[model samples]
Target: MDNRAIGRCLLFLGDVTEPGFAKTAFGLRDWARERCVGELRLPQATVSAGLPQLTCEQAAAQGASALVIGVAAPGGGIPDAWVPALAAALDAGLDIVSGMHVRLDALPALREAAARSGRRLVDVRTPPADIPIATGLPRSGRRILTVGTDCALGKKYTALALSRGLAARGADVSFRATGQTGIMIAGSGMPIDAVVSDFVAGAAEILSPAAAPGHVDVIEGQGSLFHPAFAGVSLGLLHGSQPDMFVVCHDPRRDHLLGYPASPLPSIETVIAQTIALGRVTNPAIHCVGVALNTGGMDAAVAEAEIAAYAARLPYPVADPMRGGPAFERLLDACQETS
Candidate 1:
């Protein structure tokens, strides 16, 4: 999506209790809050963006230009009840932006509303029609993917931090956003989860192509290999990115899948092994570089202690990029090592 096309936006939240699925709202709040004017929450939604709650009409009056469906809805399909609410936003002169699997144009309500209001229907999830299949050929340069034990556990944040850290060290590098929220925050990226199942890996290949031998691409990873709901996307991204090194990201507080409570989250060691075994299909030399813990709201001392505990046990660097210090510096140092 064109970055210029987006203006002050009003995010629409589905009844997603878990932060993992509703990352779009939270990511924008943390990264691009200026662009997020307000939020329209469904009655059933238990979570909040902590922004001024407003209706589409009220948001439009305040100069909101777009209504973003900010939740990764279960099954990726738009619920029938959301159609009318979305149409109302379009009717209020706000363009509709969604990264859901369903195309906004496909819904008659939204299609007709946009026609009447002369607004755009932006679907970031749709891939280009001419995308080629993944070749699995070795590419130049180096790549580091921030994989995780489950969804929304800091993969994108870790990748972004690493990219900035690498650039600060005078390395040629870029952040490759893969998921919907990451795509929105980066302003442009391949929606790896939205691609047709057969072309998912192909989409990833195009997302981060070959670069100079000295260049590094800090690729934001997708779902976990252990998540039954999104493991396919995770595997596709791993095979396509073909990273020389990967960081295992995890939220120590989470023990089970966000939505599927019965399914336990995989251990960091398990994730590291699974990533290597599966990623070998495209990049045989792939291995773990570090571990990034998501200690978002943890107390400073607690977070530091957690990092220290992990570092003492794991053979690799362990740190929270948000809680940057000597430990995080160590992780960045490991990531930049090409030899």
Candidate 2:
């Protein structure tokens, strides 16, 4: 495979390092393969070793076609380390994709540096208030299920299990996938009957059909709010569809225990409080599902306890879908009631 055709891809790992180096690298490889189509090679070139200090000379040494500089600032903090790295990557002759978690207010210097280095910059951030407002569609149903764009979040698995759970309970359920990779799975999965992708490509394949489904419509969000794939096009798709309910899938280890992105990630209590404040804007209610227990590195007990505690505080239920029976049933019940 030609390195140029493969599009040299590089990413800076921040809290992303905790997700496991191998998983993160492979995930990006899959992302490139799926999105690049026949234009580029499948396994994208990637390197990681903590968040390396980026410089023009160092970036040139990596010799990649594109670079994805990820600074895992969950609450939007930009490390001083990113500016030079962004400049270096641009000098190395690579296209740049920036995650939204980076402090947008503080990015002008980096943006200017990138421009001087002759690199294209892409930003992926979703304003909490305007995240779902991209569409004028009214709330069509009481119940809704949502999935995210990032692969690690496990949106596809959650959607499938939720659909099966709903079918088992005999609710009129319609599972809709709003991104390319997801639509592929929906086409093959027995649990889901309908699939849509291409809203990002300027087609309304997902929204138009979902607008009037008599039953509940479960839609998926593509990419992380900070990932390039989810920025402009994906947000537009979500806005047009106007999901009635939003389900946030997060890693409990990152959310509650490991203090993700920083040594002091807000506690579950804090998150709940903030969600209450934000929920009023997106929907009258919101649901959260923690997959930290299923994330393979933590003790099952820790995840179980966290889910139990978090579920109690919020208006929704949280569980370990890896258990696959009653846990999924609970999720379906929540979806039905909300729908």
Candidate 3:
């Protein structure tokens, strides 16, 4: 489904300016702005308590026909404070789109509110009904997986950029999203992390097939191999996608894992090596094709210097897709050579 068909306008409820939990909201805002999918209406003012609060009428006045619960809170559950605002938005006749594990439809009040307002409740993390267990069978055509040095290191962004860049160069490319935000953008994809552990790989396998044959499937990578809590999902995605080539995504400034401040981030070389080794468990010839650097907090000079350093260290092409240089072309060229 086209992303534009999802909603006319969206009001992101959470503050994306916050430090850690802003990745999803920021990605959605960037994607929406780039595609002209309708305006993203942020709150003009905050409550005295500093939380974002807006009535449904105010949201409509701001041209928001839908309310997106964009904050990825701790434990993936909705905050108690957000309940009232969400209910108000629902009563105001705005559809609710949420990526949180807590489904709005599951809540008695929100369900009744939607019913009363005739609004739709969209749960982005809802798993598909027909996902089968992964057979680990060999799939045809070329596939590329984006592996990351840490969680939220721009893996999905790199995958999307690669898909668009490759398609622009006349390549038949398809992006397979493994997370909620990517699912929201692509309109169709399995939320791999939400699935039961037993079916995680199976979910990836089931989502691998392209609309037509011979397309390069650019499967989005999830949690890092180093993330203590989510490493299993990452491995499942790697094996399930059975990619022929892989791109390593990293943020040079991130010295430690996102939430685990004590766990230091591994080197780029270590990340690439681990990804290749783990990927080979399902596909023996899996290789790192390129490196995607996330320079989100870095200056122009620092980002460029970091990219140059990565290029010097790694044999593969290194680029920051967000900065938009020759990285896409170089990545596509590398993929073509590998294919």
Candidate 4:
């Protein structure tokens, strides 16, 4: 299956009452709509928080070619209840694209369903073969990385936002996606965490330079230094990207790490300090350029005040890219100053 949605219409399956892992689906939908990746069909029975949701029948009727399990469900497995609807989508001739660590094709029932319907299953998290170890060689051109306070705290969104904002200002900017959602939208990227430990930094090194020599590569970061389980991957990306400038992506409302509530969230200062310290291990000149806030689930006034507070605290531009205006322009200015 083509990594790019292109002519295909997609039905995103994410309809839980409390969105946890499914939150990434919202980002995917937004990217698809903004980039015109393909048509998104909304189902009559589905309703999500401000996002269009579609049922299997509606998606098939609307010429949707694929049903994407867009959420990163807990334990990386599809919910048992979702299997029936996914099977129906397969019967309707829609392929499956899943980013979860669990491979849908490996499930006997789902595999049989796909075979019976002649549909394909694309697992984005499956690592590629023969990935090399990092050489730590220097590369040309300036690069920017989006480091987050916690996992899934809008690092990818910040990278995408900066890419768009810089391009609008007539700057040559390119985005390097390091996660599954980004790969789905950007058409190509290495699933860094899935790659072997030895190859994680190598993958980042390879991807960071794929952009044009003069264009600024806005690299998407993975995991968080505070995330105990995935911090190694974050360190590898920091070292491999060799970023000259960095952006801190954070959600001010989150007081604890997702799925790990016992772990208290670190201060923004700590996150920035740790990120810069790690980056300097490979490139001593790495500097943080700005902060991107994910002000979801906050009142407009409250969000504005919080963002203002962050800007005052940080020595650089801070803004929520979702609400574009002066903050976004300041972010672009910061990027240009580094470029």
Candidate 5:
């Protein structure tokens, strides 16, 4: 059967400590459920996609083609314990789809298993070999980049939702994926985080190339400008994309940077100022259109109140993309006003 016809596979949920890293599972569930057969979790997974549990052999028996690693590990390296389970999946007649920086075939056991079972190891994080340095040249088209106060807030979701909203208004818009999960859903994108440091800006420029003057490219963001470890990727993308406008994604519940207790998250105002200062290097007219709050799993009334408070004081529209209402509509309106 063709790969597309292979349908769902057993999504392998490993021991990913950070809840955000497990976002790949939820992304596939929401955007590409047709490609998911079931889920397979290791012993101590804290997060889940809320799918039926199934082993590799059982998933293959159900006509599942591949076992996709559903975690976007921070360092992009595979865990030592995961090798055995991946090898087992290969032996059970399931291909391995990994978006990690580490290639599956690099592991000796997985290599032998794939060779014996004739299964494939797909690596999606490979960057293009011909990527060149960013030119900083002028480009046409409107662009909205979803920035964040911290990593894994609501950048990708905001971009996707905003793109849909723009399309509903009959505007020419496209959601540009910049991470592994977004790429998986969109079918193609450069994994900005995996690209070489020297070429990340170039890769980002290629990811969302120049388009018609009226067209809009809603580029999904990665990492955070305040994040100590991953901020480099974010800056590269910001400068390369040359966004005309941006939306700052935030979660009010968390006061500090996730996983980095010492580094407190920056305020949305600071982020807006910093982005304008830095992004002007590429696009002098870059500005903030709105704010997208991550109010997922919050009480309806509480979420509304929280958004209302932000809207009352903030100069820009503040809304939760997942809970679109008046505030979100205002955000959409603000985006449309950007020239």
Candidate 6:
């Protein structure tokens, strides 16, 4: 069936302060616009003037064929307020749609409400993964190192290092496709597509009764949480498989002394906080492994030391996996315990 037939899609933006979410939404909007999906809406207060709507009546008046409700992280479960707001959308004869970030368990209740009101609803996450080789499903036994979105982000190199480092230590590791080119593998090399395909097949194998649980795999995420292009598929996939631990890569370039103009990247604290929040939202027990020290500085030692120190203060253990092999091993061991 041609699933592209979205009768109407109303985007309900959540009030996630994370930059990655905003970036992802913008990217989704652009992609949807190209596909002619539907109208996208954000809460008035959350966005700009004349865009606010306290009820579905306003949305309907604005010619919204579907109801998209924006929310912050669904705290304490689905908020009490969403129930009525959704009801109003149904009363207005509109389909109710939400982002994929919405908790999976909450869908039934929202669907029931939509059903009662004779309205349809769906989560418009990840755009249906039409990539020829991409299944958009979680694969088991694949040790994945998902990188945060944002260009020049060290996720690609970091994931590469982790995979190589693990392989050298006799741990079979697989790199998930981040849709990027020019990734180098230490051993027998394959394109990112083939690697992911193999990993998916391996995951299926692991799920079989004859398969074991010790297989390792890793995947990379494409955009920062706030980058409009950031669709957190890697994170979702990792959570689905309940990976041993999540290793976050950080970059430290101190151009502050050279009068470098401020870039709009989120502060390290913000990134870490959002990551933790995502971890809690997905799987709380997932260990957080930190890898820092990018060589993009005049004083590599100082930069590495500074970032290493900063990473140490966080809730997770921070180390230079490239340099501190022993520490990296400890982190890997910890991730395995949870797996």
* Candidate 2 off by > 4 Å: 1-135, 139-143, 147-151, 188-213, 226-234, 255-299
**Which model scores highest in lDDT?**
5
Q: Taking the tens digit of each residue's C-alpha lDDT, what string does model 6 give over 1-339?
A: 122134333444443444333332333343333321333333432431123333456546656566544333423234554565566567777775444344423656666767787776644331223223323343344344444424445565566556666767787566543331211111112222223332532332232212145666655544455444333443333433344466666555532211224445555566556666664543454555655445543365675567557656766555555555455666555545543
Model 2: residue 294 alpha-carbon error in angstroms: 4.6
Q: What is the C-alpha RMSD of each candidate to the true structure, in Å?
A: 2.6, 11.5, 3.6, 3.0, 2.7, 15.1
Task: For residue 223, give model 2's deviation from the true position in Å.
Answer: 3.0
Q: Candidates ranked by lDDT, best first? A: 5, 1, 4, 3, 6, 2
Q: For model 5, which pairs clash?
A: 8-35, 8-37
The candidate 1 region of ten consecutive residues with least summed lDDT is 1-10
Model 5 agreement with the true structure over 1-339: per-residue lDDT tens digits:
012222467788888766778888888887788778889888888788889899888898888988989987667788987888998999999988888888888898899999999999877777667899999887888899999999978898899999989899899999898887787777777889889999989988988888999999999998888899999999999999999999999998989998899998899999999999999999999999999999998999999899988888789999999888888889999999956
Q: Stretches of candidate 4 above 4 Å error?
A: 1-7, 34-58
User: What are the per-residue Cα lDDT tens digits for candidate 3 across 35-104?
Assistant: 2133232453221222234555765775667777666767888765666667777887788888888888
TM values, all candidates: 0.89, 0.45, 0.88, 0.89, 0.91, 0.44
lDDT per model vs. reference:
0.87, 0.45, 0.77, 0.78, 0.87, 0.46
**TM-score-better candidate, 1 vs 5:** 5
- TM-score of candidate 5 on Cα atoms, chains taken together: 0.91
Q: What is the Cα-based lDDT of residue 5 in candidate 6?
A: 32
Q: Please say which candidate is ahead in lDDT: 4 or 5.
A: 5
lDDT of 2 by residue, 84-201 (tens): 5556556767666543444333578766766686666644331111111123434555434443323355554465556656667786766564432233333211111111232232
What is the alpha-carbon lDDT for the whole of candidate 3?
A: 0.77
Cα lDDT tens digits for candidate 1, 1-339: 464247789999867676667878888787778889899987888889899999988898888999988888778888887888888888888998888887889988888999999999988777767778889998998999989999878998899889888889899998888877777777788888778889888888888898999999999998889999899999989998999999999998998997798999888889888999999999989989999999999899999888888888889999999888898899999997766
Per-residue error at 332 for model 6, in Å? Answer: 3.9
Q: What lDDT is reached at residue 312 by model 2?
A: 73
